[model samples]
Target: MLENSNNTVLSEVDTFTNHYPRSSIKRITRYTTLEELHSLANKPLLSIGWLIICQDTAIKNSYLKFLEGLDQSNLVLFRITSEQKCSELLSALKADKVQYRIINNYKLKEEKVIDYVCKNLSITKVDAKYLCTRSGYYLPEVVKNVQTLKVLPKITKPIIRKYTEDRRSIAVYDLVNYLIGIGGKTTYEDCMQLVYEYRYGFEHLLKTTLAQITVYIKIYNLILDGELTLANCKIKKKDLQDKEISNLHDFRLYKIVESFDKISYDYLILLQLKLQQISPKFYSGVFDFVALLKINAKPGVEARVSTKINTKISSKVKEDLKTSEKRLDEFNRKRYTMTTDDCQKAFEYLKEQRDK
Candidate 1:
């Protein structure tokens, strides 16, 4: 009776083991020199196993290639076409025709895939796998070391603790003020630094690569939302200052009603009158020289000789006066006078000079 009990116990154990589904494993051998498939056939423990769960053949091929290049030990490639029956996969494994002993059971596939990963890769749970995949950054040996794997929990904590954290949302007022502050003056290097600082300070929960993309997307959206008016943006500080000064000068000039040509002519005439009034000593000296020349003329023919000498001197003076007038005209053409206030100040100074 004891021997009969032992046989029944053994049968029960066998039945339980057989009822457990087998893991589907696909062995992807990396080729060296694109020719030898078995040249580097060593396996490393992949902390996670991924079942290529995509239905698209192109996606499958691309994922297969991606996995084949990834660490070879953790990778298993399986294909499930719509036409292929599940029994065929079992038969292939039973006949030992599969390169790897893992078989894909469509009924409990998702759980089976997770189970196979945890079993073969020596990982504790499926959450680690999800974190790594969602990170979008390629980390080949993240699961190889236990210490590095701990980063996954910290990374996922933000999602669970979302309510406790003060989330940052881009406000329209903030966007407008930021644009007005830097706007066209912000260089590419400045933008890069700003993005880095923003990510490090406010977006510590997000992955670096994702944070960068998110920042860029926000900038693009701000532009699309008409928050930033770029048509008149000045990228340089000097350029902005120069434009402001130019606008002020134009405004001042615009307020003056008199035409510049008429103003210039009136200014020249006023300058000539001022010169004539202020230089009396110079005019007196010239008059004295002419009188001396007339007095020193021949005695008996004093009037006639003095007239001839005066006529000759007057002719020479006329020529000199013509040259001086030409020079004065050129000066007036090139030089500009100050505005009404400056002219009043000059008149006051000339009156003081005359009084002295």
Candidate 2:
């Protein structure tokens, strides 16, 4: 019964999140269930909201199977995109008392969205129309393209075509792992090829790569200190929200933790150090940082194979980690104690590390 069309589900979700600016809104896909909703309902003090966006047929089927269990008493608000499913739930077969909101009436038209972009960016109706058409009139896609366009000096039809061209087949996750030398080596050409293939801005890729590095560093430290073991490495949903852990699936989290068995800690730290060095320079020029990564960010196979010679390299990495820790600590300390120019430099360094 799950219906699909040119739904404005994403824009509605964006509006919901914007409405509850201070609420700890949890966004997920098929992970949501009646039990999970009840668990959240029990914690009213958290002031949490739930936004579940599912396009998968399997997930929709799974949801339909449990629709009878849902009642009006449930506190969660479902902004489902499917009109048929909503109608079915409201029918006599399910719960007629079930409350819901249909967003189809509020959906933005192509002309309206294009005009918004045109007025906001001070661009002509032609360029804005092109962007909206290329972006499929999706609000988030249009916003992302607008941000990318803002970085450039001038907008051109060719540039819009380049940025809006979608290559859904490319696995950017594998490219990211390769960039950090997880499964294989990476090159500047490979990096730029990914840009062209995926059509994701370099800033987006850089932030994604940095996020993976941060997660690996956190998980690696826990493993090294004997605080976490693969046998008992289960992470709860609440812990993810509490500790601000990346909202990754359990399978992906497990795979990331398991990767440490083959990848060396030293290699991860080396890649992290290189990212830290270029991060500050990113504000000056993104190409400059990319060039730096090309020159110094390549982790060699020798380091990758260190897991085989752990006894020897483990000690060296531990010693080097101590020194690296001191350097990082000093770098952080200087942010508060440093002069104006130094503070601005530190600000840019931290800004590059953040995913905005």
| Candidate number achieving the greatest TM-score relative to the actual structure | 2
Clashing pairs in 1: 23-102, 23-103, 24-102, 24-103, 25-102, 184-235
Q: List the candidate 2 regions with Cα displacement exceeding 4 Å.
A: 1-172, 184-190, 195-204, 235-242, 279-284, 291-305, 308-356
Which digits, one per residue and each the tens of the lDDT, describe model 2 over residues 139-214? 7777777877876666767777666643222245655566445645454444544543323355666666666787
Give each model's whole-structure lDDT.
0.31, 0.53
What does candidate 2 score on TM? 0.41
lDDT of 1 by residue, 245-306 (tens): 22222222232211111122222233334233331232232232112122222142121111
C-alpha RMSD for every candidate:
35.4, 14.4
Which residue pairs collide, candidate 2?
A: none
**Deviation of model 2 at 346, angstroms:** 31
List where candidate 1 sits over 4 angstroms from the true fold: 1-356
Local error of candidate 1 at 133, Å?
A: 16
